[model samples]
Every structure is written in C-alpha cells, then in structure tokens.
Target: MAGVYDFTAKSLAGEDMALKRFEGQVLLIANTASACGFTPQYRGLEALHQALGPRGFSVLGFPCNQFGGQEPGDAKQIEEFCASNYAITFPMFAKIDVNGNNAHPLFNYLTNQKYGLLGRSIKWNFTKFLVDRSGKVVARHAPTAKPEALFREIEALL
Candidate 1:
C-alpha cells in the first residue's frame, strides 16, 4: 500500500529528499534528459510548476542517461544546463537510471502504480507519471505527450 510519499531520492544538489515532502501536492514526475529531442519540454514543465505551484502542484524532474545517453552531464552541469536553457525552477533530482535493475526506487514505484504502453518498464526519456494529492498515481504519459497538453488533466486534479 506504499504510495509516492514512501520513497526518497537525491536532489540535483545531492541531498536526500523524502517524497513525503510533496505528499499533498499534485505531481508530474518525469524522467528527463538534457540532450534529447524532447528536452525543450523543460520550458513547458517549468511553466506548469510556476503556474500551478501555489495551488499545491509541482513538477519533479529526474535526469536519466539511459536513453541515447542524452543526459550524460554531472549534477552541476545538469543544473547549469536547465537554468540557462529553461529557467527551470522546479525540483530536479540527480541523474539515475529509469529502467532495468538499477532504476531508482521512486521510479520503480511510479511505473508499478501505472503501466505504460511498454508495460511497467520505462521506454524513453520524458515518460511522465501524474500523481494526485493523495499520492495515488493517476495517469501515465508518453514521451510524445507534451507537457502543455497535460494542463487540463492537471488542473482538474488541482
């Protein structure tokens, strides 16, 4: 019966962050990459964070290099890239695998709560999991599903 609140992950700053901190907030948890074709989605994701943050919603980005080695940068580099390019103000986590045996536990829990077209395994960068205020996984979005396209669903949850 564990929910998203039960997991912890390292922040991009290298500090352990308990997911419980976001317990009552609606969340869009995405496996992100700096060099992927969808990297531009960061802007939309940031917009969502800024626009809905005051309403108890947030976006959590987790950098992953498993897809085409697109996000090979170290923590500092990743932080710099996001700030310079997207002005990303949302919380971002340190680089971690999003598939196979080494996938982060948070991601494992996310994928388990909602299966994608490829089953529980993540198929690419930008795969997103939406969690409601109660920490229940509500939907799973594909890499092709732009962040902006999720606004309606997110708003409803809020």
Candidate 2:
C-alpha cells in the first residue's frame, strides 16, 4: 500500500513538496477552509503544532473549496488569511479537491487507509487524518473533532 510519504503536493507557495520530508514524524493532515464555521479550529491546530512540533510532530493544512466554497481564494490569499487570522506557522498546501475523480493522490491514499464515518470519501472541510511516525494512517477524525482533543492520541504515537 502507498504510504503518506509516497506522495507529493504543491505548497501554498506553488513549489512541489515531497511528503518524505515529513517521514518519521507524527502528522495531522487536515483539509481546511478559510471561511467555514470550523475555521477557528486553525488556532487549535496551530497550537498543537507549536506544542508538539519539537517532538517530531507537525500539522499539514490543505485548503479545500469542495465544501460550500468556503475556501475561495488563490494561493496567496489563502496563505495571507491563515497567517493574518490564525497566525498559522505550519505548512499549508495549495487548494485541492478532497473528493471526486480530481482528488489529489495524497488524499485518495488517506481515505483509502482509513475510512471515515461516511466511508472512503472525505465528508467535509477540516476532516483530519492522523499519520504515525512510520507514515501509516492511524486514525481518521471528523470535521467536528477539535484539534485539542487529539493530544492524547498524538502523545501516544510520540
């Protein structure tokens, strides 16, 4: 099976990013939106990144517009919004689809590794997948799951 490190995605800056850079680190891979009701969760996710980052953990944000057009922005806009509003310091990716035939390869592998409550397809923006240090998808979190609530699971992996 393809692991998280087997894929690459474009960063918000438009540079191709190889996931191998994150190998051996616990990861919270989240599909995000800038204007959604759960947008505030960015703060908590940033906090998690700051608190656990020194211990081989990081948060990867992938902005998506698939859900209600909430993340309608170009790469620069998305980057600016995240920095100005949430002060996000973690890596943010270019806009991508989380569902359908056009879905990014990384997201396809993620949903395949761990099915959500609704099945393999992502249900909404902010849907999160926890990848362990070995690059396996360990858990799938719903959009409603708070970032702070994931501390114990992340700590266990670390």
Candidate 3:
C-alpha cells in the first residue's frame, strides 16, 4: 500500500475497515503496546484526535505485541486499558505483528514508505506513521516521539 487509503484493517470488532474511510483526511497510524514506555502517548493521541478530528484529521491505534510482547492482552482487555487509563476514543485494531515475516501488510507498506531510525523495521511499539490526505506515508516517527509533536504536520495535511 502506498497510501493510507490503499489499505484495509480489521477493527476491534474483527470487521474490515477500509482505509478509504479516512479519505481526504490526515491520519496518524500507530503501533501501540500497553506495557511500552511510550504507552502514555495515548493521551496525547486522544487529544490530537479530538482536537483535529473535526478538521478532517484522525488517529488510528493498532495494538502490537511483537516488540518484547509489550501488548499481551486480548481485545477486550486492551479496550479496557485504553479507556480506563488513557480515555482513548480513536479506533484500535486487533493485535498484530509489526516485525518479521508475519508482519501485517499495511505495516509492511508503511515501513517501506518511511524508514525509521533503525531503517525499514520498526524499532519498537508506539512507532508512528503519518499519512497525508492522499494516503501516502509522509513521515515515520520513532516510538519516543510525542504525539503532540506531530500536530504541525497533521494540521498541514488538514
């Protein structure tokens, strides 16, 4: 996939959600882990989503346990954690492997479009990809990068 709209992903409900749902919008696609040091970024993400969502921008959170198995919970548990802890309102997808041969195709496409500090492979959970309204991956952010730090580019897209 060359752009966010070029892909589809399983929602927490296990239903196929087309990336086209975000057409003409800026999207922040992130691989998250409840136990990762960057887990707290969820708050910032939620803030961004709420603040910019009305302006045609969104944040999509995908849980991944591949890195050190940081996100080991099932769907329900993950949902509970995100709600109770971070009050996350953005969409969250099922657990996916973000590394190795079993990596999700969407992530594979994202990494190729925007390499991280560690190159194509994502270094850890919370790594983020910014997709412009055209669906193309525009930037790759390290796990430590704060969500608030991305507002400028996201606004530019909007």
**Pairs in clash, predicted candidate 3:** 3-135, 4-135
lDDT rank, highest first? Answer: 2, 1, 3
Query: Which lDDT value does model 2 have at 100?
Result: 96
Each model's lDDT: 0.95, 0.96, 0.89
In model 1, which runs have C-alpha deviations exceeding 4 angstroms? Answer: none
**TM-score of candidate 3 on Cα atoms, chains taken together:** 0.96
lDDT per residue as tens, model 3, 50-134: 9999998889999999888889999999999999999999999988888889999899899888887888999998899998887
lDDT of 1: 0.95
Clashes of each: 0, 0, 2
Q: Per-residue lDDT for 1-158 in model 1, tens only?
A: 78899999999999999999998999999999999999999999999999999999999999999999999899999999999999999999999998889989888898988999999999999999999999999999999999999999999999
Q: For each candidate, give its TM-score against the true structure.
A: 0.98, 0.99, 0.96
Per TM-score, what order, best first?
Answer: 2, 1, 3
User: Relative to the unseen true structure, what is the C-alpha lDDT of residue 105 in candidate 2, on a scale of 0 to 100?
Assistant: 95
Residue-level error in angstroms, candidate 1, position 137: 0.2
Worst 10 residues of 3 by lDDT: 1-10
